[model samples]
Target: MNKLISELRRTALVAGDRVALSGEHEQFTYTGLIVAVDNLAEELSQRGVRRAALIADNSPAWIAVDLACLQAGVALIPIPAFFSAEQLEHTLTSCGADTLISDRRASDAQIASVLAGSTATSAFESQPQFRLWSLAVADQAASLPLGTVKLTYTSGSTGAPKGVCLSADKLFATAAALNTALLATPLQRHLAVLPLATLLENVAGVYAGLLRGAEVILPRVQSLGWAGSSGMEISDLTSCIDHWQPDSAVLLPQILKGLIAIAEQGHWQPPTSLQYLAVGGARVAPEQISQARDLGLPVYEGYGLSECGSVVSLNTPAAERAGSAGKILSHCDVDISDGQVMVKGNVYLGYLGGAELDSNDILATGDIGELDDEGFLWLKGRSKNLLVSSYGRNISPEWPESELLAYAGVGQCLVIGDAEAYCSALIFVTPGYSYEDIGRYIRECNQRLPDYAQIRRWAALPKRLTVADGMLTANGRIKRDVILHTYPELVAHCYPGIVYPIGGSQRAFTPTQTMNSQTDIDT
Candidate 1:
């Protein structure tokens, strides 16, 4: 595998040359990017800054520091822009970061001092001691690392962050997987629709775009209807695509749905040069793919996690699977044991703060899946997240939730009866929708489901799902545990008493009994 820095150096030799990256941000030629990285690398080394945390909005420099890490061999931790101040404090301190990087707009001294103090072990809940630097100033002293590349955290440690260590070579290897999958040669152009911080998008979206020598487009967040500073906006995305016209890109399921919506509204046109649309991060409804296809979009499903440097499986332009998260990429060595997906190759070194990963460094992904006769993999559900009823039956909630989405005005629904007395759900309906109408809609939806699989009762959440509320991920999947934790009252209404398992002496129902929709409504 080519080390990340070496690849950049090789690509930059021609200078003023090189193509778009991952078909998103129209970054500088290899020569320009190399020079910038080299300069940044020198600046960091001169200051003797071995490790730094990158906290900033979307910008070309964000990725520069990322690549500079590869060159300097210093590990980089990227905090998502959407992370709250509290979340940020925990992540930075937990990672023991020494230097902090941010944009011009975020040059608050108090915030900087607080962040710097987090690195000190003694700081604990208090901020550590460190130096904060703004993007405007160029460090006179920078050096490139010949070692580890980057460290990313994903909700693993509960309170503190867990780091996934990816070497420059592995990061580059992940990018290489896409070159073949995307048919991305020197001529293609890709766009970065998702955040650059995510390992999945960072590796596949940006690095893959570069491997093909393609132009990468990254539009402003505001243009995309991202009301907050964190996620991408639809308006910005459509505008970027219409203006630059990229060939390939990566997106989450919801973004694909949004594109389909825009096309249905006749507001955007599918690019003539466009080829692959990689979708992943959460379970994408099969119908969502069909709907996008009806609008002339070629959206391919994918599956991955931060530990795998983002991509584990992708449906390449060559071997396409409609519903399955394409075949495992060349970079990942995947196997299914006992209905669970286990992967090892290119796995992260360990979590942050010196805690070791599971035995054998193999990530036994909790996600349940199966490989078909043709070898295409389809996801079923999460093992840990599976809901078990008081009646001793385990239920895969996603199976039922996907069915609910097909109903009009049914925005989001969470099946929450795991280890509980009876099955119930917490639903977030489409804006301005009435709970009365939703009840009718769910009743109809339930009629189509088996008795065991049907939701017995439901409660409407007062608020819409949002990242701010921790109810949704960046891709818009319900944060199951977070939702339940925030709305215990709603949860309790469905399962009134402590869930008790049915005894062995339980008897069968009488022949005179008739079916009922929910126990709430007396039959």
Candidate 2:
């Protein structure tokens, strides 16, 4: 048996009545959770389910299904409900899953269409919250790498998301490391903020919380006001946090920004029950981190990728350094190779349908980072995103972008300057803010950056960069190539001799000119 299951059983035997999982309207004690997992595992094994796909909202049943799959030795694939129809089809078909278990009713046309040809069954009749269907797919056990138990897909910068193959041991190893790091604080109750399908939330949030014997809150995605990867109702989320008063939670940088905005506007205050609020999914601005701490939010920054089984390093209350990704977790050893971060231990098996990787092979993270003298991992940006100026100076766009994001007025932004004399930016202003607000923020950001990396020109986009529009990943990271391809005219306007519509007039810039005044730059 896997370590996760073994630990769950041990906890159940010791504290059977203790609440292990809590949903919006239901709760499960440790004993109840184990019984549910055992029953579902037996059903899956009886039905000969080689590989299973799960699609459901955040709920106790979701985790029960995941645990059941692990115990039954069935490969499980979690399909994000927010994925586009094309992506959904690709994942369901490509993973070679023979069974699909989901709570979504047949009324959802999009999901129903995807399940058109599958055969319906009563395999999970005892579990009223979900339906089990058998898919007529070819057996693909030979194709998968040995010991592969979970297949997770990341909504990358491209349309086709690849499935990351991970073993049960590696997944639990990451959870163990995270649990060890947090032993100092000892979380009692953890609220699920991100979608449970997210690998980070699955391993770090659910697995680690369970190992620590803490109550895991699993509210529906709609209740949290999450819409896809880019949209969220911050007010609803903060209200939920206030209602639950959870001791631990995880968040993306965008969510943290929203919380900071609401707190700054005096509309809401962070609950004191929150002990450790970990922020990940993307690089967060140092200024934002400082602002959150000032407002009494216990925010910590961490870094990870699906390739590394979710969390590679994190910051705990016992040991932390703001702006860094935190000391590397005990499960992995990190090395800087050619300015890129490479991880050796506790790495993934390989991508689905790809050659199996040896256990000792180093995984290049594609991110540029370094270890500090105190063992903190500091991230710069994506190695491929480095911009070279006409003056032969190399700069990372994330440096200036992070500064602009420090101001709440700038909702989303991207720095652009390749072979150009100076840097330029594409900014999306917040709803209540104006171009002037973003212009001033850019000026402030420029002051902090060197001349070569400063934003000398900028254009305000008409609409927000959203996941639906293919401008951002579901986790709120900007898709640089997609944005560049989508708005060629606006990009050209930032260069020279091109006027693009902004507000009520044309905004253009000249070569070798600096935006010293708010009016001088068109945001």
Candidate 3:
């Protein structure tokens, strides 16, 4: 129980006949994987490169490095492929990482340039040589404990990425907790759709998959058309799902939406082998899950944050609540305090910005949520995103956006902050969709919403916000600041109007008070 490597090594000894890891191009038996890890451990030990960064996409190599790091005690770091160049550079600098492993086929000149300039923390006096290797880059290894494993950075853009210091015990605790929950089902085979850098995936996807004696499938992000398209494109996803046929996978809600669309279009049939599609990152519509299930996709939602070691609350096949992120797991204690989630368990040791869990030990999750009597968690929205109107009522954009997403014409919504003017929204219409068609649809949709919650005025944007542009997470949460800054003109056209109810043949409602002619669209 020292490291995941030990468990994997032991399993490989007995499960040598079983398939341990699979990729778009390569598949390895348990024995083959153990040997690969042993070989890489030997090579890395020689290079004097104990600590390594696996910045590459999901592949056999990624899993190999992960295992190799454990075997050699190199203390590895997995870099999310969705990170921006600035975010990427900051992670490299923060981690004091001396070597990086990347996908050869996917590496662009720009990433190489970024790698060359990447520096280790200046504090480390006996720093090892920093280098970058493509997937094709030959194997090499150097040492153990990678000399007090450096910090792991999150996907947050608020500041220079804060490093989360984890101990061997903390990660081990996470694996044990997750393994106990999964019951180590041997018939399991996990297809990883999320980036391995995600704690949710690394712990629950890779480690859990391995410890369960499941074959972990790592599909190529590029082949899945994750390169140019928003990572959730349906056709590409259909192709990958058909090819890999994993028993389970952790999916973000955005990815679930695409999978739902694929089912709706009858473009593909979800694999008969598929089970346990764990959707998270944002609230998922129950209807979306139900529709997928009707079409034979075993999709459901779960809840976790990076700071909590990922698996805080999950909906399992054994025990599930359709609309709720099911019972909080035994590993952690979740309590609802003033509508916020407070967690205490084997969470992060501390953050780089010097934020420690208060003596109370509850990780103050800014999200507003409630716990049901059955212990299922129902999320309201972020307290920071709450919009209080002139009438003194708090309205969250997520509620309205969630409603709008249930409709067909809507693609993205940014409920605006307008206390003085009125509660307004900046809506991004879907691609090739006309305002007239959307307006007609929203007109019908208005019958379902209350007058105050109705979107008053909204404008169509030319395109969606992208991860590369810093306007989205890999999971596609609307980066509100980026949306407002990038589409200031669009927001200006939508607010402070006397909105009329949809489909009603009414001119408009008379204004009770004079307001700004056009909203400034500033956050």
For this target, which candidate reaches the highest TM-score against the unseen true structure?
2
| Model 2 misplaced stretches (Cα beyond 4 Å) | 138-142, 385-523
Judge candidate 2 at residue 422 and give its lDDT: 64
RMSD for each of the candidates: 13.2, 11.6, 12.5
In order of lDDT, best first, we have: 2, 3, 1
lDDT of each: 0.63, 0.81, 0.64
Query: Against the true structure, candidate 2 has what lDDT?
Result: 0.81
Candidate 2 weakest ten by summed lDDT: 506-515
Q: 1 or 2, which is superior by TM-score?
A: 2
What candidate 1 gets wrong by more than 4 Å, as runs, is 19-27, 106-148, 155-161, 184-187, 229-233, 354-360, 386-523
Candidate 1 local accuracy as lDDT?
0.63
* Winner by lDDT: 2
Cα-based TM-score, every candidate = 0.67, 0.76, 0.68
Q: Write the residue-wise lDDT of candidate 1 on 1-523 in tens digits.
A: 2366676677677544764332223356677777777877776776666677776545555666677766775668776554445456666555556676655223363245444423322210111222244222123322222344677765232223356666666677788876776653333677766656666668888787766566676654454445432133566678777776777777765567668878999988887767777777666767888888777787788888777778888776677677798888788788889999988786766655454543257888888898877657788877786654432234577867877788767788887765453457777678876656766776776665544456667766666789886778998778887666666666655666534334343222211212122324220
Instruction: Give lDDT: candidate 3, residue 106.
Output: 27
lDDT score, candidate 3: 0.64
lDDT by residue for model 2 (103-184), tens: 8776674478778877678748447778888776755433678888999986533345678999999999999999898889
Rate residue 215 of model 1 by lDDT: 68
